[model samples]
Target: MDVADGVLVAGYRIVRRLGSGGMGTVYLAQHPRLPRWDALKVLDDRHDSDSEFHARFLREAELAARLQHPNLVAVHDRGEDHGRLWIAMQYIDGGDLAGLIRRGPQVLTVERAVRILGDAAAGLDEIHRAGLLHRDVKPANILLTTDADGSDRVLVTDFGVAHPIEDGVKQSGGVATTLAYAAPEQFGDGPVDHRADVYALGCTLYQMLTGSVPFPRTGAGSVMYAHLHEPPPRPSAANPQVPKDFDAVIATAMAKNPADRFASCGALAAAARAALTPTPRRRATRLSVAALVIILVAAAALVGVLSRTTPSQARPVRTPVSGSVDGSQWGAFAYIAQAFPDLLPGFPYGSGYEELSGCLPQDTKYNNVPLDTSLPIGTLFCLGNRDPVIDLEIVCNADRTPIQPGVALADFPEGDEAWSRPSGSGHLFWGHTTFTDTGSDLDGHTTGVLEIFFDRADRNFCRIQVVGTPTTGADLRAAWWPGAPL
Candidate 1:
């Protein structure tokens, strides 16, 4: 019902209308007992006779009220007044994301898009954790507010289309999804879960980055048909300024097969954050002799200590090789340190390496770290070694394989197996292993030997590969200790 201003609905005094949609009308209302104002949502009076619509309205209130997360809108109370059901929620002064995108340059920056959608992803994860699915997740449904620090805090609002676990994706009627953001499975009768939300979030991220949906609305059923039969257009194609790494993130998130998508909303957000993170690059500068001497002395001392200690009882390195372990070029290191701090042990960042290159697809032609993983098979960070036969390369796995601690080196790369060991926290793995590539992009079936170490915690997939000179597993372990220089 269109209640006039100054009217009371369930003890909340209606001040003015905020907005209205297919679900109901939202009003800015002042609470009777509290001094704060609340957004009062009144269910449509026309649906009072329909039990299904009424139940859906109450379900939204109940589901949202139980979810208590900063990323989600808070539900205060719900009741029926004047034969109309009403739910009171926190009132946000800022407008929705849709309005922001439309008013601005029609798109948001990578940082802002990630920030807004990352928070929204957390809210979606919370909803999934509550055994509920927000079937309708669009930019218009996301409300953005400013925090005390003047930072944007986005909250996922409008749970009117939330589906409970009991529904099992079969809503009796046809797909109840927005055509632009709906997952392919939503079109046909299949089981919908948290992945459906992931698909929609991916679409939302695509819009935020490219200022347009994956598929344009060409006709009545063309967009829906494209979502079912076609692949999503790359965000970079629409906006050249969009980072290349985002292409893979969006592709995986919008994968037609739910099995191919990330396991959860949190995983998708983590991937997006990681994609936006910069990788290490080589700088045009000379290394200091004093720093080099210090690193060499530390490495020598570490080797001597390892000679005495047993493999199982090896000690953790206490001192950093240098103060500049986390350098300006070490962007991936910074990214990992931000999320998983213990994974990176302040290894001298800018001191050792002369040239850093990623193992790209065939004939990619690169002199520096690639901006995206479009053709990345792995990363190779080369150090300036005097002996041509000896290659010291840092292998960062871009294959996205999930390698865990205690796994043998033979299991990961093909070659002669030597030895492998895990760090104290089981987040990093260092192994001196040999592998033979048969017609591969990197080595081309040639038998090669290398000492490899990778971060097994997050999806950074960073690995340190030392080719030539096959040393004992224990020696490699001690030589490449966490805080020691490479």
Candidate 2:
């Protein structure tokens, strides 16, 4: 088909062919009015008269459109242009994960693998939450994009083969799914649900981390048999740097029985996050410092050993400032503020106080304090006592060493230095909240903290930061307490 022969559909001008697959051919298109671009998938005319295929296609489109998540590609509009069925979706500039792996180095860092799979899990969770299963989840269906801020983001696409949970009818012969990533249930009459997606995600993650499929077989039936009976080897066996916990997570996700796997995609994502945590000792060191500092300060005040200082004695905390000050309320405001322009639009801006104005209560007593009391660990805040402002930083520490403070705010810039010196707007009264390690050897603890800041009389921000620790949840709970007096 010639690219220029078709009329513009839904105001998107088709530029050129992107790629063709079993479902349809995708075209590169641009919105006539908006600056955004899109990929338009047009089903071939051969299927137009087939009612069953059309119904299935429409159902898939409806299901995909209902899902709105960061890791899922969004469908913008669907219609017929010149008697051809077409769907417009957000255009991702980057290539598929499979292509990236096939080219050059093929191996991925443990952090990169976990992060990508975690994002895909989140997307799958959203899909399952909507009562749909991505029957065809594979590396080729997962797209990778680097935001303007340089953070890697994963987008799960091509849900044309996805099955709706409520629909009892089985899809008849025609298009075949990728065997490499297909779960065993997909090969037979076993019950399929969110667990199938989990299994496929496990296979995808395995391939991504090790640069090879879990079961490499020349025949589709052989691969399916392996998925049905064999337990995949640990990724750490291939790459020593991969954590043992990750191996357990993958094994669990790829369990032969659906009941043996995580209950949902969200659970799998949470497990992946837990497995991705670095050695416990380092995490503990990050958490310990924050906990110890808070405890010591509290203890000193409780005992007669340290006198409580009046507001006059408090000093104005100085630190660099920029972007929206309201970010402080969420614990990683500074990072989000600096990262917004590159990550997303519509960032609030003004004096730090002005940016935070809407989030603050009218009552002066709680003016600068975060509205949310029970925040995720590692949130930073700005405290002022009607006089000089104090930079209140909370961070995770293990073995007494502070992990850099600030939460990983969505749509925020990603980099170690970005957390330290965020771009744009400047004032300095900085404080970082950190977690600490509690083990005898600092190797077992995980540190996580939130950061918030009050600078001069204007700019202030809050943020949450976390570092993994080897310590248990009980110890973390015991050590976690805001330093403010009750």
Candidate-wise lDDT, in order: 0.63, 0.55
Writing each residue's lDDT as its tens digit, candidate 1 over 125-226 gives 999999999988877789998899988989999888888877786645555666668898887776888899999999888867765557754222556788
Lowest lDDT block of 10, candidate 2: 353-362
lDDT of 2 by residue, 224-314 (tens): 6788898876977754456678788889889988889888766877887788874656445756778977876887777663345533236
Give candidate 2's error at residue 323 in angstroms. 40
Give lDDT: candidate 1, residue 310. Answer: 48
TM-score of 2: 0.54
**Per-candidate TM vs. native?**
0.57, 0.54
> What is the lDDT for 378 in model 1?
40
- Against the true structure, whose lDDT is highest? 1
